[model samples]
Every structure is written in C-alpha cells, then in structure tokens.
Target: MTAFAEERRADRAADAEQRRIDAAAVDARRIEREKAADERASRLNEQRQTDRVRAREAQARTRAERRAARGEALTPGNVYRKGTLALVTASALGSLPAQVLHFVGISPMLLPLPLAIEGAAWVMAAGVAYADERHLPGWVRWFLRLLVLAAAGFAASINYTYGLHLPGLSAPDRQAAGIGLAAVTLLGPVLFEIRQWVTTLSADTNSPEERARRRHERKRRRQHRSIAQLADRFVSAAPFGQLDFEEAFAHAWEIETGTSTPGMTPRLHQRAARSTAALAQAQRSAVGDSTGRGLFGRLFRRQTESSPIQNPNQDESPQSITNRLGSDLQESAPETPPAGTEPPTPESADPAPAVAPEPVAGPVAEVEPVKSAEPPVLRPVAAVESGPRRATGRVPQSARTPRPTRTPDELLTEARSATADWPDEKLTAEAIRKAVRTSSANGRLLRDALKAERAERAVSEAQAA
Candidate 1:
C-alpha cells in the first residue's frame, strides 16, 4: 500500500508538472497576443497621426494659396503708387548729368543756377507726385511743369555741349550718350505727365471693374480739358477749381463769341453778374435824373413864388406885365399903344432914317388892356377909311385889306431859341433871316435882332475878360 501511494504521488507530480507546462504555454501565448495587440494599437495610432499631419499640411497649403491670391489682388494699387515715386525719382535724377559736368569742371560756368533750378524742380516733382492735381490751380500746376521741363532741357543741353568730349569715351559713345540725353530731356515733360496720369488712374482701382470705371472717367476728363483750353483762349482765363468746369467754360465761350454754340448755353453765375451790373447802372442813372429834376424844379418854384413880393407896390400895367413875363420865361411881346393913340417910337431902332420902316413878318403886336377897376371898350377900329383902298375903288368894308402889322419881341425869342443849337459860325444875320422866312423879312425886326446880338457879344466878351 505504501509503494502504491508513492507511485500515485509520482504520477500526480508528473501531472502537476504537465499542467504547469500547459499553463506556462497558455501564459506565453497570452503575452504574445498582448504584444501583438500593443503593436497593432501603436501602428493604428501612427496612421492616425499621419492623417492629422496630412490634413494640417493640406490646410496650410490652402492658406498659402489664399494668401497668394490676395497679394496678387493688391499688387496693382501698390504698383501704381510705386510708379508715381519712380517718375518723381526720374525727374530728380535728370539733374545728374549737369551736376556731373560741373563737378568735373566741364561746365563750371553753367553750374550754380542749373543746380538750384534742378533742386527746386525735384521738390516740386515730389509734391506733385503725392498730391491730387485736380485740387491745384491749372495755371499754377502748368507753370510748375513748364519750369521742370525747362530745367531738364537746360541740364541736358549743358551736358551735351560740355561733357560730350569726356576723355575716355569714343566719338560713337559720346554721340549716343548725347542723343539719349537729349531725347530724355525733350520728353521729360511728356513722360512725367503720362506717368502721373497712370498713377492717378490706377490708384484705388484694384479690381477690373474699378479699373474700367476709372478709364471711363479719364476719357470724360480728357474731353473736358480740351474744351476748357478752347474757352480759355477765346474768353478770360478762369483757373480750374475756382468754378464748375463745364458751366464756366460754356459761359465763357458764349461771352467771347457773341453767340451760343449748338448744345451749350451760358451759366447762371455769368448771367447773374451781367444782370447785376446793368441793374446797378440803371439805379445810378435814375438817381442822377431825379437829383437834376429836383434841383431845377426847386429853383423855378422859388423864382415864381418870390416874384409877387418883389413888385408889390408897382401897378399892374400892360408894360409891367410884359416886363414880368419876359423876365420869367423870356417870351413876352413888345407893348403897343391903343389904336386911337399914335404908335410909340421903336426902342431898338437905328438912328439913320434913310430907309422907310418895314413891316415885321412875325406875330402882330397889339396892345393888351390891363385888368383894372374900370371896364374897357372893345370896339373895332372904324376905318378912318384908310387912304389906298378908298381911292382905288368904293370897296366894301369886308373887301378892304388891313395894313401889315409889325412883329413882336416874342417872335425874336422864338428865333433865338430855334438857333440855340446852331454853331457860332452859322449864326450870321443872313442865315437867321433865311431861317426865319422863305421870302423877305422886316428891316425893323432885323435891326432889333442885330442890336440884341451886339449887346450879347459885349456882355460875353466882358465876362470872358
């Protein structure tokens, strides 16, 4: 029984050993599976990391592309600004040749003035490049441009004249250099203007649509500039920016030509200025006329109003009435005696009585009865049966012709007034007689007129002396 038990224990021990071996194998397999699983997990994590890296790289590439597109989009505006800078730089550089010649003693006499001019030109160029020309006065900008061009030409000419014979250069090289410099100098103004124009057109026009709009605007500006130049030549020189371009130019054209063009008319400001001037002139003329009338009217009123006070004690006789009316308006007739009384001797008759007194040719002088307390008779002159008519035939009273009446002093006044505008040389007695009558004139009236003329001449001479 003890031996059987030991064999059994040995068998059990073997069994236990076999079982341990199987367990160990199982453990080893489990370890191997865990190792394989860890390796697969690590491989999968690596693949995920690679995918993330690829995604990041793709995103970075897209960002780079987007940045490149935006840069391209912004390039035009920057380039335009750079072009302006370049033009200004070139203008400044145009002074180099003359400066070089001066430094080398080739153009010593032509140095200082040209150097100063070029320096000023450079400063102007820089200002013009950065500023908007539309804001500047046309004449000012034009003058500055001309100055710069002149400076460039002067510099180029000096270089050509003095620096052409530089020691190391061949004839061909010298000629080529001279020609090139001359060409650049002559074209300096044009090149600068074109460059400035390009800069202005390209500035702020980044997209194609904006550029197209700018081009259209430039075309319109060109048309307006041409019209403005024409208007300036014909009319007054109104600078740009001081007025509206199209309207100002149109008004100027109308004013200069004295007629309007087909599609253009004058502006409101131009019309307003003219209207204001005319209105002012009219007002001045009205004021002057009113002042003159008031002055003359006041003088006449004072004269008429004071006449009664001066002659209050004098009787109102026919002679006095004649004198008063003659002094007032210089139109009174000479006083005559009544029909029954003999005619008064003429106040202005000549002393010589060789010629018989002739009848006056103007209005008949008649005695005008004065207004008195007594009523006067109004009877026709009964023909004392005048001599000639009764002796010729037993003519009826109605058929008898009355004697010719003498002219009054009132007709002499009319004659004087009629000849007022006549020249002094044309105011002879014969001319006055001819103007007064187509036929013969009265000798008595002529003699009176002659006396009056002599008196007037004496008075004028005394005053002049």
Candidate 2:
C-alpha cells in the first residue's frame, strides 16, 4: 500500500509537470503572436509616415510650380502676355456691355447683333495671327487687317452714338462720354492687334542663325533652279505630308544625278574609281613588288655588270644559286702541274707583271671536269602563278554545301512561316539572312516583302476597326 501511494504521488507529479509545460508553450505562442502584431503595427506606422512625407513633398513641389507659373518669374514673356490679356479683358468687359445695352434698347432680338459685331472683330484679329503662323501672303494679312479695323470702327461708331443719346448726360458731357466710349470700344481689338504685332516682331521669333539658314536655302534654290523645280514636282506628286520639303529635295537630287546617293553621279563614281585605281597602280609600280616593275631591274643590272657573273644556265632558284657557287669553286680551284711534271721554282718562273684575271677566270691549260657515269639531274624552276587566291575565313566553292535557289514567293512564304511570332524590328536583313541562311540580297528582298505584308495587314485591321 505504501508502494502504491508512492506511484500515485509520482503520477500526480508527472501530470503537474505536463500541465506546466503546456502552459509554458501557450505563453510562448502568445508572446510570439504579440511580437508579430507589434511588428505589423510598427510597419504600418512607418508606411503611413512615409506616405505622408511623400504627399507633403509632392504638395510642396506642386505649390512651388503653381507659384512660379502664376508669377511668371521663370518666363518674362508670360508677364507681357498675361498683362495684355488682362487689359484686353477689362476693355472688352467695359465696351461690350454698353454695346449690348444700346442694341438691346432697340430690340431684344437684336441683342445678338452686338455680340456678332464684337465676334467679327475678334475673328479678324485671330485671322491675322493664323496668317502669320501659316506664312500666308502679305495681301492675305493686309486684307484681314482691313476687316479687323472696319469691324472695330463700326462698333466704335455704335458705342459713340449710344453714349451721345444717353438719358442722364448733358450735351458737352454726352460728347465727352461718346468719345470715351468710342475710344474704349476700339481700344480692345487694337490692343490685341498690337500684342500680335509685338509677338511677331520679337527677336526671339527668328534668331540670326535661323535667318542665315533661310538665306542659304534661298541661295541654294536659286543656284540649282532645275533641281528646285524637280523638288517641287516631287513634293506635288507624293501623298500630302508623307514627305517633307528636304526629303523631297533629296529625292530630286538623286534623280537628277542618276545615282542612289544624292549629289553623286555614275559618271563621277567611274571617274573617281579610275583615279584611285590609277594611283594604286602607280604606287605598286614604284615599289619593287613581286609582280615585277620597279627600280629593281635597273639596280640589279648595274650590280651584275660590276660583280662577277653567274652561269647563263642559272634560273631564279636556290638550286641555281648553289650550282653557280659550285661552278665558281671549280673554276677558282688551284691548278696543279700534270702528275709527272715537276713544279716550277721561282727561278724558272716567268718574270711577267702580275695580271688581273679575265671576265671568265681560267687556267691556260684546261683540265677536264670529273664526269659522272649517270646524266645530271635537271630540276625545273618553281613557277609562281598569279591567280585569284582562295579567301581565308571562307569555304571553298567545291567544299561548300550547294543550296538550291529559291524563288521570291517560295522564300517569302518560308520566311513568313519561320518568323511568324518574331517582331518587326527583328526581321532585319542580317537577322533574316542568318535565320533563313540565304544570300544578303535575298534577305533584303524577304525583309521588304514581309514589311509590306505586315503593313498591308495593319492597314486592313485598321480599316476593319
């Protein structure tokens, strides 16, 4: 019973220990969750702070831009433009109401009459600006200017008459009021016209360099009158706005020169080719090249004349030189008396003066050369043929794989299939050449065909849309 009691105590202790462990695990998990939540809350605060700071910065930048734009400190021209706009606005507001009232007194339906008159004046003023921007004829500008003055004059007269007939004014006061009304009524469009003139006359409209360019262009047109006419013709023939004046002029130059490149001609190209080739040939001839013309012949001839000569049988070869050296050795070999004859002493030697050797050095008595039983071998001279050399980094024609020639339609069909998913820019001449393994010319042809096909497809799609 004591043993059973001890086991019961131990079981209780074990259960207590397990409970404590579970409590500790729960606490640890709770702590971890709290830590994660704290981290998330901290991150949220940081993100909110960052966004607030960014918004403040953006607002500050916008405010600064607004300030600069309203003040026009960054652009002085804006000051003039905005000031003119204000003056014109004030003038129009002062004049337009009087005209409207004067006309409205006549008829309610005639209210639009004053507005039309005022609109006509503004429209003519705007027409002057449009004419200037379009580089229209001076006559067109003058005509528009005359219309602006006429509209303004008509409005001013109406304003003056309305002021004169006002109910509250005396005679002299009416005249003054009439003059003032007429002056203010005319001043609005006149001020706008003046502003337009000032903008046109501003030096910034055309720089000195820009003026020089125009002068140069005009001079060139005068110099090349025919080319200019051709350029005009080309401009007229092309679709509107498809080609600019300069590009059309370039095409004209190409046509006139009979070449693909503008300002160059086939005749000039041939002449240049001849000149360069002649210079290269002259340079080659001046130098002692293997192809053989130069001072080499003259120099070598003089040397041969001064120096001991070689055998006539010698050709231009290493063996020929060796054979010549051998023959020389034999000729220069010390002569010996006949086998039976005694050698001559100084006493019996002839006292003749020492003499120089002849052109062909030899002994008075000839000794036979040692003959061989077999005939001498004759080696042929090495001949260097000047034919076209096989190009390095290229396969020989015989070694290359023979590719069957493909027609444009067949090749284009194949290319289209091969490159269906490829982008337009990737379908260049070189890329097509590598991908299709075709000639450069054929690659270009295929590229053009594919481009045309894609363009047509795009056009059709757009039309369908």
Candidate 3:
C-alpha cells in the first residue's frame, strides 16, 4: 500500500511539471503576439504621419506651381515699389497743404492749381515709365523728364513762398517751415521720378551677376567697336531660324580675328606652347633631384655648373633654368668584388694587380699596379655613384625592409662559419654578404678579419719553418 501511494505521488509530480511547461509556452506565445501587434501599431502610426507630411508638401508644391503659372506671386520688386509709393504719398501730403494755401491766396478758383501741379509732375514721371514700356523714342522720355523736373521746381517754389508767409510763426520758425515745405515738395517729385527711372531701366529686376555681365559686354563693345558692328550686321543678315545672335557673333568674331578660335593668334599659341614646355622641363628637373631637398634646393638651384646643352623643353634663357645631368636614372653598377675574389696567378699570392677601370660616362679613374712578393692589401673601391638611381626615383624590385642589426662580432662569426669551406680566393665580401644576407660594411669587416687571420698563419708557418 505504501509503495502504491509513492508511485501515485510520483505520477502526480510528473503531470504537474508537464503542465507548468505547457503554461509557460502558452504565456511566451501570448507575449510574442502582443509585441508583434504593438510593433504593427507603431509602424502604422509612423506611416500615417509620413503620408500626412507628404500630402502637406504636395499641397505646398501645387500652390507654388499655380502662383508661378499666373505670374502673380509676391516679389521683392513689388515690395520695393509699394514701400517707395508710401513714402512718396506721405511727402506729397506733407507739402501739398502749404502749396494749396499759397495758391488760394489769389482766388478760390486757383484751388485746383496745386493739385494739378502735383498731379502733373507724377503723371510725367509715370509717362516716362510708359515710354519705356511702349519702346518710344529717347526724345519722348527726355521730354517727360524735363516736364517732371519743371513741375517739381514750380511746386517747391510755391511751397517756399507759402512757408515764408505762414501765419502765427516767428521769423526763424517761418523760414525753417518754408525750407521744410520746399524740401518735401521737391522730394516727392524726385522720389517718384527715381522710382520711374528704376522701373524703366529694369535695374532692380536684374541680378548682380546679370548686371556685371551687361557691364562687361558694354565694355567689350566699346573696346572692339568694329567687331561689335560686324557681329550686329551678321546677326541681322542671318536667317531667323538658322542662326542665333551668339552663333552669328561667333562667326563674325572668327572672320574678324582671322582665326578659327576667338582671341587666339598663331604667335600667342606658339608662346603658350613654349611656356608649357618650359614648365614641363622645370618639373622634370624638380623630380630628378636625388637629394631630399627637392622642396627648395631644386627650385632655387644655382645656374653654376649647369649644362650648356639647351633642352628643347627649356626656356631660351638657359641661365635661369635648372638642369640635372645624368638624370637617366641608370641602374647602379654591380658592387665591386672584394680582394678574396681575386684570381690566383703564377706570381706571388699578394702581388698588386692592375685594377680595371669601372665603365662610366664621366671622367675615368686609373689604379697603378705594384710589383712585390707580398703586396699591400688593396682596398676594394666602392661602386661608382654615377648611376643616379642609387637615391633617385626608381621602381624598386622588392620592399626595402631593413635587415635585423647585429654586432660586428656576431657578423664576423656568421661570415666565418658560412665561408670557412670556401677557398680563400672565392671568399669575397660581396659573396659573404649574399651568403649571410648582411650589409656591405659587415661583409667587408668579416672579409678583412679572415685576411688578417691568413696573414698571421703565414707568418707563424714561416717561424715554424
């Protein structure tokens, strides 16, 4: 009975464990579904906001396009004209009362005289703009301008007379009032006339760049009046659709300059070519400088010791040019072989052999051979630097990583071990450097150590004998 009870408890525990896992899985799936729904809601809200913003932008674009088609959009010129009109109106009102009173002193019928005077001046100012719009003769615009000035002058005189005799004013006050009235009367007409001039000239409509271009064009026409006239004639003669003003002018310019291109003569082209060649030659000399001081030295290189051979690319004044001889960047001659590489002759082992001259383009060097049983150790000459490519710009065969530095003793030990089996005559410093992959200085030192050892042994053998 106890065993059965324990088994039943175990079964119950297993069922509870399975139920807990199933509940956890169901809760996890519910959480995942809620997260996905929230994400969808957030994305839908963002898309709605985006669509609203785009709709607003599209509406604004449509409004702008409509305004453009009607040509009634607000402009800076409209604002300027409106502001100027307000000022002119205020000036007129300020000065017109005194002028009307001055004219009224004569007769009541003269009341309209001041208005007529003021209105006529403005009419003439407007007429100047009208003349420009109608493309009228220059004389017509000038006539209207003269009338505007005459009307403004008459109005100013009337205002001055009225202010001088103003009622309830002291002498000084009356004089100031008269001056103020006269100034206002004159300013109203002048302001109006200036505004008309601005409109007529279309000065405010043109951008600064457009104005500058027009100024340049006017100057060019003045400088080349014949070209301008010919261009104008050609433009007038050309068929309407076949040629444009600029194209016709271009043809006329070519004909007038007697060249296919405008503003270029054969002499000018030749001069340009020469200048380009000189510049290129200067570049070659600059890059050819082997010394790291190409920054300034090559540019300011003195003409001293400069070659006389005039490079076709060089300027005629050879004194001012920088030239480098032996700039062909030839490969450096093979490194001079060491003394151990010397061949064995029938004569004494240490006889000084005549050194063969290294092939070079410049001056040759000669070494005199000496005849002695035990000749002095001949120091091998360093390779000639006539090749310029030693330091000049040459494409290297391999990356120039510096070898690990070792001490003199370490270098000697390595060389001795590597070349011990080699014959004495074949044990050259160049050979040791290649065999051990060491520097020239270390190889030379090792070769000398071996030679000294050989000399000491020969002496010891003689003592033994």
Give Cα-based local distance difference scores for all models: 0.54, 0.69, 0.66
Name the TM-score of candidate 3: 0.40
TM-score of 2: 0.41
Model 2 lDDT, full chain set: 0.69
The sequence of per-residue lDDT tens digits that candidate 3 reaches over residues 318-340 is 22111221332233322343444
Predicted candidate 2 versus true structure: per-residue lDDT over 1-465, tens digit per residue: 999999999999999999999999999999999999999999999999999999999999999999977777547677777787888788788789889999899899999999999899999999998987888999998999999899999999998998899888799999998898899988888888888888887744369887888888899899888989998888899899987988888878888886667557767776666665555446433434321223323333443465545322122244433344322323231244335544444465434334433332222234333333333222222223333222223222222223465544555667778878999879897887677766555566567556655654553454443
Worst 10 residues of 3 by lDDT: 313-322
Best by lDDT: 2
> Alpha-carbon error at 435 in model 2, in Å?
68
Indicate the residue-level lDDT of 83 in model 3: 75
Cα lDDT tens digits, model 1, 279-340, are 54453332223213332233334543766343221223334344443122212233433455
| Residue 324, candidate 1: C-alpha displacement in angstroms | 99
Model 1 TM-score (2 dp): 0.35
